[model samples]
Target: MNTATPWITGVRQICLAVEDCDATIRRYYDQVGIGPWAVWTPKLTNTKIRGKTQPYSLRVAMAWTGDFMWEVVQPLEGPSIFREFLDEHGEGVHHVLVETGTEDFDQVLAEATARGLPPIMEGSWEETDFAYLQSEHALKTNIEVLRRSPIFKGRPEPDYYYPFPPPQDSPE
Candidate 1:
């Protein structure tokens, strides 16, 4: 059903969620050989879900794995559907967001809605217009991906920080 360029751009970033960002980053950092990562956490944003006010912070550790950016996220102080995902399953790949270019950002979102893919997530407010909609078959996937504004393209490649080492003694 996806013929026209659905969003502003194309598939740009891939995100993963982990129970332990430090260990996961370390795994990619040491074991996986992905390094030089960057850590970013967004401030709390208020979103309405099921007619209730929800607050949440988008916490994540991002790194470039070859061409795609691998993001590990943890929901801090909020009621994120992502958190609900953890409760249902576990931390893992959440979403595959396709960058919709900046121009006619509103049109992209409107198109999604008009085309019948109401966005589960957007870059900013509902009025700003630019946003992304999750796939109709998202529930049957390994993760959930939401795209942001396409202003940032060719996101600098990140590094995997996993440099495998000795096994630390477990805390007893």
Candidate 2:
């Protein structure tokens, strides 16, 4: 007695990791050129992936583009997605996000699984309804011409790369 939910939305943003966040921002603000601040969250970084050289001081930048927003993420330290891109591509466009419309995120997740698109995170965001398809599966989606952008831009770009001096309290 299970029912499946349907889609009701599309991509809202595509995040990318850059080498020089300021430079990247200027390029868009000065080059591609868009507009006057819509809404942006403060720098919220501080996630590390151990055994990496993230610099622990990254930044995330975003701006409106046409009908969607272009987000740029600059990793501060360790070997984050940003660093991965810099090491290979040297900074640029990243992944495209398809906003979930169906409330039955679980249904969608199941669908993706059926399609061989297993997920990585499902704690809350990747629940039964809203989930991200592995990079390979995203490409195979065949929904559009280009394959899914890549896994680099799936997550939101943080404001800072790492936490400062550690929180006042640690698990005691």
**Local accuracy by lDDT, each model:** 0.53, 0.45
Residue-pair clashes per prediction, in order, are 31, 20
Over 106-157, each residue of candidate 2 has an lDDT whose tens digit, in order, gives: 5555565565555532212111122335443356321211122224334343
Cα lDDT over the full model 2? 0.45
Instruction: List candidate 2 segments past 4 Å from native.
Output: 1-8, 37-58, 105-110, 120-132, 136-172
Q: State the lDDT of candidate 1 residue by residue for 1-172, as single tens digits.
A: 2436534356656667566677777777777676555655543343543335555566566665456666677777656656766877787776665655563545555566676566564333222222325552644532222334446343232222233321333110
- Model 1 — TM-score against the truth? 0.64
Candidate 2 similarity to native, TM-score: 0.52
What TM-score, computed on C-alpha atoms, does each candidate reach?
0.64, 0.52
Candidate 2: worst-modelled 10 consecutive residues by lDDT: 121-130
